[model samples]
Target: MRLVVCLKAVPASTEVAMDPVTHTIVRDGGDAVWNPYDTAALEVALRLKDEARAAGQEGWVGVVSMGIPATASLLEDALSRGADEALLLSDRAFAGSDTIATCYALTLGIGRLCAEPDLILCGKMAVDGDTAQIGPMLAAALRLPVVTGATTVERHGAAVDVEQVFDGARRRLCMHGPGVVTVDKDAATLRMPSIEGVLAARRTSVPVATAADLGADLDRCGLAGSPTQVVSCFVPERASDAVAIEGTPAEQAATLAYLMGEVLA
Candidate 1:
């Protein structure tokens, strides 16, 4: 079995700055880390790899990402976490890609990694965009089945059983191999990298794939391929001052209860 985990490097801090012209986040000059949710997906992928190894089955795990060349550092992080191989898709042509365009590029890159992958894992949403669209879009491009918001996954024969949190409830589902899943934070916590793993990753070579290498069309990549355009971005104006209620603890509770009842009722 072969698993491909897709990850993104996003700004580590909540303080994000936008480009005045493009209205996009200024990613190049920020301190970044692997998307928090992607870490959970990586954990799930590593666990599956371990399970396969314990069963004496031949399994390969690869980490794939599309970002600037500087973001290649995240590949080492992924490798230290247990990915057998890493591929970085980087090129100037791939810059300014929207969700749709990004997914299109990723699909091509994934195809280059393996003719057909047994499983693909991704974070439920990227902290940068918060769109939660790329995973499903990639699935569509690959013509593969997808399970979203997955909290847990178990391999069963030729199928994969997944548990997801939906509308405040847990739902279980079973799907065949060659599928994609967008994982939630509750999926699993990423394991810390040991010194040996870190050294191993440092020694490993990470292959870089360009847009041309992926056989991507110029008109179907980056800003040209993006359908949606950002018109403008601005901070909302502040609202009025808050209303303070002064009273004893019990009186305050009573007042809060009354306000809640009045508002809800």
Candidate 2:
């Protein structure tokens, strides 16, 4: 069984910057980490790989991400945690992409990974984008069935069965062969890298794919292809409504106590 996991490198800090001109996240460089939800998907892929090995069948997991050159570091991290292969889709042409354009680039690169993957997994949504649109869109692009918000997956020969969570209820679904699943963080716990695996990651050479390599239509990529436009990005103003008691320290304390008593009463 072959599994393709779409990984994403998101800003580690909440203090993400925005580009003034392009209106895109200014990822010029700060520490980056693999999206935790995507890590959950990888965990599922690893478990499936182990199961296939136990059954004396071939299992391979390939991890791919789309971002700047720094994204390779995240892929290497995946390698240290047991991903069989890694690929990075990075190109100047892929900048300022909205969810639709982003999915298009991913479809191109994943297509290059394998003509037909047995199973495709993605994080339910990226922390940076938080749109949760890529998985379904990519599935549609490839003409494959997809299950979103999947909490559990069980492969049955050529078919895969999945359980999805919604409004505190779980629903089971079975999809035909060659499908996609968007996994939530609750799906599985991620494993840490082993010492030996960390050492081996240094020697792994990850391939980089350009827009041309993905056969991307220049018009349908980057800011040019993105339909959604950000009119402006700014920090929201914080407002609070409260009364200030002005007096000597003791008097203020007494007034605050009286107010608290009134509220409690």
Candidate 3:
């Protein structure tokens, strides 16, 4: 089984700022961490790989991400967590890519990483974006079947069984791979890296690719290719005030009623 997991480096701080002119999030000041949901996806892939290997079958897990050069550290983190290899698609041309352009670059990058991967996995959403669009969009670009919000997964040959929860309901599905799945947080817990894995990851230099390396069309890889435009981004102002009516139950109820009537009138 050859599996690939999509990873992301998101801002670690909740207090993120926006560029006044560009309307884009300011990402330079704070540290970055792996997207929370992607951790579950990675855990799922690692378990699947272990199962395949234990069955005397070949299993490989590769992690891929599209981000700036600094994001390579995130790939190394995935390596320590048990991925076999890591690839980073980083180029100045890929800066400011919206969901569409991001998926376009990833599609080409994944094609370069694995010619015929059995399964592709991604987090249901990235915390920074919260759009939950990358997995389905990448699947559409790759022309493969996709299942999103997968809470559990089991593989049998080329088929996969998936369970998901939606709108207070649970649904199970069976799908065939070469496909994509966006794993939910409920899927599995991420495992800690062993000392050996940590040392190995420290020595392993993740391969970084650029748009030219992936043969990406420059016109469709970044801001130029992004159709969605952010008109503005700012935190809404908030007001905090408290009023108390101190009296017996009946008096309090009468006061509340009077206040409501006055406000309505």
Candidate 4:
């Protein structure tokens, strides 16, 4: 059996700033880290591999990440954490990709790496985009069954079961064959890398595949294929003012309420 996990590199800081002129993420000169949700997805794949081994079947875990050339470091991190293989999808033409384009490129790359994976995992959402759209999109494009927001997963024989969380309920999903699932925030965290693993990961030669290598259509793998367009992106100006409340405590409370009502109205 083979398992594949999808990953994204996101800004380390939560307060990621946008470029005032370009209206795009200020990705330059910022520390980039693997998406937290993707880490959970990796952990899920590792655990599934362990279970499969115990069941007398061996499984390999691989990861696929798409971004600039710098993102190869992101895949190395996954290798350090114990993925058996990693693939990087980097190309200039892949810039400014929306979720649709992203899913297309990812599915193309993953399909090349693992023609028939027993399972596929992804984070419930990317920290930067927070759209949570790629997992299902990839599944649909590949014509495979999918379930999202999985907090727990179990595999028995050829069937995979997951505890899927929705708005106000948790549904148990069972798939009889190869399928995809997105790990929720509540999934297990990954273990830290060992000294030897860290050094080995740095030496891991991750192969990069471009749009041509993945056989991705030029029009469907980048900004040109993206339907969503950004009109503008700028931080909202903060407005702040202080008002003095001159009176007894009761009167101050009443004045505060009145001011709040005015602001709300």
| Per-model TM-score versus the true fold | 0.90, 0.88, 0.91, 0.87
Candidates' C-alpha lDDT? 0.87, 0.90, 0.89, 0.86
Candidate 2 TM-score, C-alpha based: 0.88
Worst 10 residues of 2 by lDDT: 229-238
lDDT-wise, the better of 1 and 2 is 2
List model 2 lDDT by residue over 1-265, tens digit each. 9999999888899898888888899886478888989999999999999888889999999998889998888899899988888899999999999988888899988988877789999999998878999999999999998999999988888788899998899999998889999999899988999998888998998899999888899899999999996767677998797998999999999999999999999
Q: Please give the TM-score that candidate 4 achieves against the real structure.
A: 0.87
Candidates' RMSD to native: 2.9, 5.2, 2.3, 2.9
Error of 3 at 194 (Å): 0.9
In candidate 4, what residue range of length 10 has the lowest lDDT sum?
A: 21-30
Better of 2 and 4 by TM-score: 2
What's the candidate order when arranged by decreasing lDDT? 2, 3, 1, 4
Top-TM-score candidate index: 3
Candidate 1: tens digits of C-alpha lDDT, residues 11-54: 88888787776666777835889998899999998888888888
**Index of the highest-lDDT prediction:** 2
Candidate 3: how large is its RMSD? 2.3
lDDT of 1 at 64: 91
Off by over 4 Å in 4: 15-22, 236-264
